[model samples]
Target: MAAASELRSDHALMLAVRDGELDALGELFERHHRPLFGFLYKLTSDRSAAEDITQVVFQRMLKYRHTYRDDGSFTAWMYHLARRCAADHFRRSSQAPHATDPAGLAEHADDRPHAGQHAASRDDHALLRTALSRLEHDDREVLLLARFQELSFAEVADILGCSVGAAKVRAHRALHALRDIYFRLQNPSRASSLE
Candidate 1:
């Protein structure tokens, strides 16, 4: 039994949550909600939808607490639930592949890219966001998990239920596809650059 004053690990907290400790569940939500929301928002490109999906992840965690394995990583488990929740949301919604994020394309870029680099950098950010929005769901998932979410290939593999090598391959293919889309958007005539 962990003392009340002692810092409990995420895994321990989640286990306690599985055992119906509300405080433990709260702790896990406090630690993880933002990352889950960010990943969902980026993937779905809808703030309200992301917020709803974030709540669903925790709700499902509580609803399916028994499924959580004590030996497994809590973060990975949360992401797995979040991914499922997002999938369900997509099934219920009619959003297009290029669902526009209300936050806009250049939101993540620097306040001002260096003058000489400004045009290119702005184009990069906008086109990249556009390209990402246009990506296939699986490819976008790989990008959000492995790159934006900063999860290692192993963690991503766990969340994705794929082997590490397969996750890496998928991410590689996704990056290639993203690059092709970005270039194709930049110049329609240059689509042959992919070949």
Candidate 2:
């Protein structure tokens, strides 16, 4: 199982990456790329844009290696970088009338399966993505950092530059909002399974 895989802390991995260990970078990428891409793709609602931002975030990490602090967890630092990249990408795209075309949204939606062996709502994935996008940036960031990144509340607080109490509240609000949006999207009128 993926969870059963030997779990090395992000801090340990980054120290290696900082020392020019290419394999460490590969391991970090392999461990995080999917969930990070999913989180960004959902946040931006645009696959190509998310991909570009993710690459830029990683590149920026490499460029800013000298600035890394031993006192902080590398994962939190990387998450902060990604959150900034995603926020910037959203800001720019929102300013342009034709910033994100339908094709881009569709591509991002490709991250979700159209059908599945499990009976969970396939549409819920898309609905969840939409719900996540609707949240305030801080709320969304904390929730995604916790759920997708699997960061502890303390780590999320560090990445978000917020207090742990604030992170917990934000996560709660985001989850509540997600539940509301999910049920609304899967309203009983549209989904017989919801009843």
Candidate 3:
């Protein structure tokens, strides 16, 4: 037989969490925290908020653990919870998602790839972030799910509570929008050259 941890799938670990085995949640956290933090950081540029939201995701997972269904994808369900956590955070705070928190950003640099440490890299990061931020909320979200998170359309549909076809269509539209924004930000005069 495989080792206990080796044999336990994500769902099995989640089921253990649901059964009041809180330690199981730590296992889940170890497995997912990096990606979860990355997704949140992209969603909310404020590193502090992203960290907070990541923690809240797990807290909600534990709070709502009873609702977990064996048939559902654990990661999809976790993302659904994370999306709501972000929505709630945005709703409570008046700042735009791309708004800055300089001190926090400085402190959080080691947690993510260094973006502002060099000139060329800084320009690249700034342009991409600007393009991403210019997208409509739903558009940015769909793009992030498909491109950055690398989730399948079906999993995205589950998280977004939409049909798989709708998810695919949204991602396609979002990518078009992102490309337009990127080119425009790169050079206003050269925007049409991208076509």
Candidate 4:
């Protein structure tokens, strides 16, 4: 038999929330808040803004509970709402998102016995963040949703309001763009030749 927690899928919990069992929304929040915060943090590169947006996401989830359909995965629905909240934040602030500090990225890195290895890893992460920030917003968003968040292509498509095939193509193109940027950042001398 499955564990009680395992048996209670996000869909089920969200259904309960839709049915007015308000505490179920707390369970949903607990399950999703961290990854949602990470997604927002990566998108905005501002901890304070990410924190505010994360809270607003859950609030919107609760307010818009009735709109969630049983046929859809809760994760997709949540991300869709989150994307809208992020867009709204950008519209209100009229600011482009920036790259997060390499030090902040280092917080997530594993400790290594070798200082050189650790420094190399940090540098790579910084380069990656800069590359990601340089990407067009749509490209960055596709990569974040598909790779960082580990959503299925189908889920990404739903969040993006496109077909799964379209989602896959976007992810592929975004990944290639990121790879090019990362390489250029690593080898600036070679960048002009490649272009």
Candidate 5:
């Protein structure tokens, strides 16, 4: 026989929590906390803040368990809550999100066989992170949801509280914007001339 947890979908787990089976939330947390933290880390460019917000998100899940509904994806619902938590964190801090430090980017360096290639890749990643950080919060958010989080347009729309078409449009525009910023960061002389 399948274990109770193995038999339960994410929605089922969440629904169980909503119905006062609070321990079920542990399974959901085990399943989602890493990806949630990754999303928060990328969005905030601050590992400590991401860790803090991650805990708050779960606390919120417990506090707001009654709001869970059967009609939506639990992942989408979780991200919706995550977005609000991050926004609230930023608001309370009264500061704009910043780029990750170049040194910090080292933590994400690829484990390639070639040292030279790894260094180049690391630099490229740093540049991209900087470019992403330079984008407006909303643009960064849409890209994070659609690209980094790998959420479908439907789920992205659900989390963003928009129509699917609108979510796609936002993702499209955000990608174009990121591309422009990335290339500009790569070519400072050309960027200055074009400005």
Candidate 6:
């Protein structure tokens, strides 16, 4: 179950948006845009395309304003829109397949020579990003939605068109896969930093 505060925030803004208040939508955008953009950036590995897709997702939200109901969580509905937008982008890009290389994957292990923990942090982020990118689209989608978007399993399932139990199972598997990739790339050294 969502916290009362979270539900209150999302629900209140959604109600305002429904009432023809553009600032409500702007507030929602300001609150969610960064994490959502980061989620898309990690998923597609294309910042420009992610920006385009985010715009498309919000535009579609405007188009479907009448369909939004206070009974449902706004995050879940927005994620559903994101999932569709990502799928559409993937479908279009599938026509021009590019070879996956381990070269960029090496960046995961590349820690800059520095004195402080900043380089360590950079490597850790790179490792997570590379590992995240390595996941299958479905797995990546669930992981990002759960970790980055901070959504519940039920919300993730609704967005992905899967059952809550299935979403939970997938999230577990995706986390495991991400861990495996992290260890395999560099070693167990970074694992401690991750936590």
Query: How far off is residue 174 in model 3, in Å?
Result: 0.6
Cand. 3 TM to true fold: 0.81
Each model's lDDT comes to: 0.81, 0.70, 0.81, 0.86, 0.86, 0.74
* Root-mean-square deviation of candidate 6: 7.1
Query: Candidate 1, residue 169: CA error in Å?
Result: 0.8
Q: Name the runs in model 5 displaced over 4 angstroms.
A: 108-120, 191-195
The digit string of per-residue lDDT tens for model 1 on 1-195 reads 875614888899988888878678887887788778878877887777888999999999999999999689888888899988888888888554455752563443223446677666666777787788878889999998999888899999999989999999999999999988888978867745533
TM-score of each: 0.79, 0.74, 0.81, 0.86, 0.87, 0.77
Candidates arranged by TM-score, highest first: 5, 4, 3, 1, 6, 2
RMSD of each: 4.7, 5.6, 4.5, 3.6, 3.1, 7.1
Q: Which tens-of-lDDT digit does each residue in 1-195 have in candidate 3?
A: 776865788899999989988888988998888888878877787777889999999999999999999898898888889899999999899655763333344344334565457787766766777677667778888888788878889999998989999999999989999888887868967755633
Q: In lDDT terms, which candidate is top?
A: 5
Clashes of each: 0, 0, 0, 0, 0, 0
Q: Summarize candidate 4's per-residue lDDT along 89-112 as a digit string, tens digits.
A: 999999878665556654432223
Cα miss at 32, model 1 (Å)? 1.4
- What TM-score number comes out for model 2? 0.74
Residue-level lDDT of model 2, residues 39-148, one tens digit each, is: 77756655777789888888877777666787888778878888888778768767411223323455562355535435566445556665566566666666778887
Where model 6 places Cα greater than 4 Å from the true spot, the runs are 1-8, 95-116, 187-195
- lDDT-sorted candidate list, best first: 5, 4, 3, 1, 6, 2
Error of 6 at 50 (Å): 0.5
In candidate 2, list every pair of residues with a backbone clash: none
Q: Tell me model 1's lDDT, rounded to 2 decimals.
A: 0.81
